[model samples]
Target: MLQLKVIQEVITLILFVVFSLVFFKNETLKWNPIIGMCFLVLAAYFIFKK
Candidate 1:
């Protein structure tokens, strides 16, 4: 189902972000990637908007 996929993707993204932040302290978070993630979640929202 669309809803299930969205939830899984969001959870995966959060886990990946947390893992990256905790393991890769040398690299600072950037706005572009953050915005890109936001767009991904937003796209999922639109898909479920119907």
Candidate 2:
């Protein structure tokens, strides 16, 4: 149950950023956010890396 919740949160975070980048023309992808997203993805990877 806990693992599922963590996965969902990570996916949600990624999707939110992706959707924002796709739908919001005014919003540009900056370096800081990109780095943050990379870290988030890494966290997700570690979580599932059994």
Candidate 3:
């Protein structure tokens, strides 16, 4: 279930960001975290690719 874990991680990251943004107005989103999420998405892509 490595694939499952990777997908879960990607979804978790997305939800975490959304939750933080919705619940914490004072906190600002930064480029670094976005970049990290992008990389995680890329990793998920490669793992699922055949």
Q: TM-score per candidate, in order?
A: 0.72, 0.70, 0.93
Candidate that beats the other on lDDT, 1 or 3, i.e. the better one: 3
Give one digit per residue, the lDDT tens place, for model 2 in 1-50: 76788788878888988899889979888899889878877877888799
Q: Write model 3 residue lDDT over 1-50, tens digit each, in one string.
A: 99999989999989999999999989999999999999998999899899
lDDT of each: 0.88, 0.84, 0.95
The TM-score that candidate 2 achieves is 0.70
Candidate closer to the true structure by TM-score (higher is better), 1 or 2? 1
Better of 2 and 3 by lDDT: 3
Model 2 lDDT on a 0 to 1 scale: 0.84
Root-mean-square deviation of Cα positions for candidate 1 versus the true structure, in angstroms: 1.8
Residue 9 lDDT in model 1? 88
Candidate 3 runs further than 4 Å off:
none
Winning model by lDDT: 3
Misplaced by over 4 Å in model 2 are none
